[model samples]
Target: MSTIDNTFEAQSSAGVSGPATRGSIIARLERLPANAMLVRARILIGLATFFDGFDVIAIAATLPILIGKWHLTPWDVALLIGASSVGQLIGAFLFPWYAERHGRVKAIALSSGVIGVTSIACGFAPSFAVFFALRIVQGIGLGGELPVAATYINEICRAHGRGRFVLLYEIVFPVGLLASNALGAWIVPRFGWEAMYFIGGVPLILFFVLRKLVPESPRWLAERGRMSEAADAVHAFERTAKTALPPMGDPASFESMVARHPKRKMSDLFGKAYWKRSAAVAMLWMTCGVIQYGLSTWLPTIYRTVYHAPLQLALNLAVAASVLGVLGSLLCAMLVDKVGRKPIINWSFMLCALSLALAGVFHDASVYVVAMCCAFALGWLACGFITAYVYTPELYPTSIRAFGCGVGGAWLKLAAIFAPTLVSKTMIGGNLDVAFYLLAVVPFLAALVVQFLGIETKGKVLEQLEA
Candidate 1:
């Protein structure tokens, strides 16, 4: 047996007798077939994720209007674009900590409520200052929702096809982005920018749905020594299984595994075993964040200002790019298992870099040319960006998975904050190309980080990979 399997065996042997040992819980969960319950869980969680995507880019769709309405300067625009990310950074740390302690379902529900309430408040904001403040508060919820959601999604799946399952669900996020852009084109011009915020706030209702429908992650429950609850959670899936479950191994043998490994401190993410993984994933999130936010969040405004596209046309162009982004995420969801996480991420980042470089080089070309180039770049980055969500949780053990994802999420929020400001500063001298050129460097550097530092987790069980 390999070291991980051997250690698992040893731990199992040492475990106390229990009806649902950690080993049995994992085995049962892995053995359970995909069923209606699983589908329901994905849908419930995905609804929240979809709205997270919607709210993220809704500001982009509204920005052109906000800029004109407020007579905002570039700095004000940057702050407005970046305000949510600042709050998200705080949430990235806070909610994951909450998830680790309070349980994933509660954390997700609470954050969703925060997002829903604050987003509605944003719709009623009378001035730029109020809207910005509301966004920051809403961001606290937005930031908390994703990483914890990602962690929750990652924890529940079997390792074999986990990438496909998780990424397929994650595709809803880009779809949400696409929906916001597409709807923004129709709604903002017709109903007003306030309508978008009101629509985005609709996720508030999802809070109740999630609390009522989804059970806690059994893996997390097992790790926390809540074996009976974990067993109950597992049995919920077991009841849904169309095929008979494989025999769960000796219960006592697996029960002690959690005790054997013990829960890790948050600092352990930067400690010897995990620091490199932490660094690489953090870099990946930042690279993806910078490209995604710097480009997607600003694309409409860029179209309106730099390229002189009509308002409707600007939003429409952004919707086109978002369509490409959703397609790219779907492609990643399909290919990640076969292609392996590291290769897809590494190659996609390089391709994104190439496209961005070209966009920068020919930035002075026709608007169609620049928009198409940026669209392609966003599409390619979407591939890597979606994959990062699948890969980040695999890097750490269950003990700190949510926490690790939170730290990585923090880096993403930092990038979100930095990218807009950087783009705004670069746009001051009509140096739009300079922003693209700078963004191009980030993914290229990230590609190297992945090539050198990232581990392949494709088809590997999370515990074994961490071991």
Candidate 2:
């Protein structure tokens, strides 16, 4: 079979029962289990994303230390930060295609290894130029991690528990952020900035673990005409997961698999029924990027500038506040399916707006008051988008899901590029109130956009969603 033909037909009999081209995929989803293999997959991806979050935040956390150690100027610091962001931009735009063309499991493994090695190298860099270059490389690795993880989970996770499962992955980000901040606090004081890099490199060790354990995504395999191998993977999943998975049919010829699944191109995302949904996901993710990244990158800076706290004190506060963010994400995972996407998002944002507004009031308030407001805002901000990470894949049909998710989420990395720059420049320029006030607008806008364009997928099947 031609590679293109193989691509569409590559599902393991165990992974999915239908041809990729027709019928609802969700009906097939019911057969998969909430088994150990499924939890392992989610944990593996969550841990990887946790590291991605850790690496990104670790760089920021160590900046104060880097400034003192390296004697960097303001411009140098900006360049250092910008380098990683630029690399993330390139990776987010291009990595999905690589995964689609090469393989999802391979792409995920490579991205993880790259982040690990680059993180280690970042610690030992002899100069700012080299350090910035390594940061860019690490960014590329981190950037690829999320989309690949999302695609992996989307293919393997059963329809019933998929929403909570994916949100669990999202919850890992704040968990990672808290880890990074905790590391920064412990090591930056005792061991200095390089310690963060050393710790960040640990996930590289998981590369071998992943290589041995992480199977090729069965859905991708079935779509690609490698049915037998895919089927083997499914059996392995059932064994390890302890789930009563569906049995695979007789191994199909590659030609027959293609005749079943059919390849979907990126351009399919623009089709009549899908474009609006795509646009909604794009906006929602972008808004998520603006608020989440904006606040995270700037929290320490805010504490330092407004509260006149020491850098150590500010980072400590940011670390504590990050824990609140994690708690909020966990809450989202708990409530999202029950509350429904729109309501959780709407309520999260309304609370976020109020929190941000409260934070704005504390621009000059007492230290305890300021900390309380920031903590509340952080909770709302984290939960608001924990829901998005779960909702995006549900928005598209299986044939085009990866594409829909990749494209819809592109705006997030795009927002990351500009939000940090804008927030840092404006807030540090003594317009801190303006920064918080502007952030207050995002949740409202996110709520409005979701209300207008969002569909409730809470307990509905994915097949019905596609129709």
Candidate 3:
């Protein structure tokens, strides 16, 4: 039918010593039964991402109030947001080593527990320093969850449908934002800003469920030559699938199965052959972090200040826009498998950039159109990174995939650390248009880099993508 369908039918295998065929992956997954296990995996990971999205963006929506309450200068507000990014940067680098050692599912579970505890702590912190401290801890959890989720999905997903699966996983981030924004709008007026964190801490519920339900990545076991354990894991999955009454592929005997190819080192990804890709994806993620956090976080503030929307109205709009943003994540999930990751990202970034430019320059547009366009821009821009979330894992092998996603993500958080101040300064200096224009420029550079250096990862399996 379609390219994606054809690819799914073919089952592309990149790491197992053969050419990637698009049909094989879909066929493999088809053997598994339809049941609660897969659903649980998606929901658990998605819920974590949802909390992350909320944690990442909540500051923006809450900032104006914090400013008023604490007598905050722009610089102080920037520092508050930057602190979390710094934690994310550190966590991104460190989590890979831990995930490599401990396993992806375990890392995620630990991060979830960390986020949950830290989030509740943040809610009760009586001072700015304590609040900021909790954010750093919260960020560690956020940063670790991502690479772990990527590795987990990559390990379990069928090759042909992997892109879509990853995209779906990525959707949780935006969905989390939607939930947070809505909750903040409702809770902030009733219970004060701190209550949002109490609500955000609800993800702790996921932690207990995760420990009981989520399985360790079988592929990780295979790579480590723990074949018996790997086979046991797969057998557990197949048995679970069979009980659910779905067709499944024959479970390969662990003893008969060959181990993964020789371990690919983290350093290899930065060498000549892959350096170009590393740069492109890194820059793409960096640019996305700058633009996304800068805009989405500030939208409610802008509405309150420039448009003179009431605080309640501004918060409502932010919450509404955040909900609408899920469309972008869903769009990426739908199209990334078929059209290819590069084109979607290239075009999505371009559209996002253009919309931001228009929003900034056309100060006199009808309010309804401005609302529609801003929502559209946020949705489009949000998708660019969502695609990257799925695309990044595909660029490196299983041995180093966690590392690759981690490093790329570290740059993104680093970019985000600076963007809040950059946007604030530009807006405060009466050059808001300039900020939008600058944002537009970064994506163009990002698109050019991708055109020249990006890799196509539509149908390939995780291990096959490695050098």
> Pick by lDDT: which candidate is best?
1
Rank candidates by TM-score, best first.
Answer: 1, 3, 2
Q: Model 1: runs farther than 4 Å from truth?
A: 1-18, 249-262
lDDT of each residue in 1-467, candidate 3, tens digit only:
76444333332221122222222222234345544567678888778877888878778667778879878776787788887888888888878768888788777877878788888888788888888888888888887788778767766776667778778878888888887788778778788888888777877887777867876776776666554445444444544553543443333322122233455788977886579879987888898788767777877787777678888888888876776679887978898889999999889878887887787676556555556667777888877888888888778766777888898888888898998898789868977767777777877788888878998878865555655
lDDT of 2: 0.72
- Using lDDT, rank the candidates from best to worst: 1, 3, 2
**What is the per-residue lDDT of model 2 for residues 180-220, given as tens digits with 9 covering 90 to 100?**
98878778888878889988997787677885777777666
Which should have the higher lDDT, number 1 or number 3? 1
Q: Which stretches of candidate 2 lie over 4 Å from their true place?
A: 1-29, 73-76, 241-263
Q: Pick the candidate with the highest TM-score.
A: 1
Residue 292 of model 2 has an lDDT of 64
Note the Cα lDDT for every prediction shown. Answer: 0.87, 0.72, 0.74
In candidate 1 the C-alpha lDDT for residue 240 amounts to 74
Model 1: pairs clashing at backbone N, Cα or C within 3 Å: 12-253
The residue-by-residue lDDT of candidate 1 on 1-467, one tens digit each, is: 66444434433442323355678777766666777778888999999999999999899889998998999998999998889999999999999999999899889998999999998999999999999999999999999999999999988898889999999999999999999999999999999999999988878997777877888999999888887677667666666776655655554444444445646788889988888898899899999889988888999999888889999889988999999999999989999999999999999999999999999999999888999999999999999999989999998888789989989999999999989988888888889999999999999999999888888999976776664
- Ten-residue region with minimum lDDT total, candidate 1: 9-18
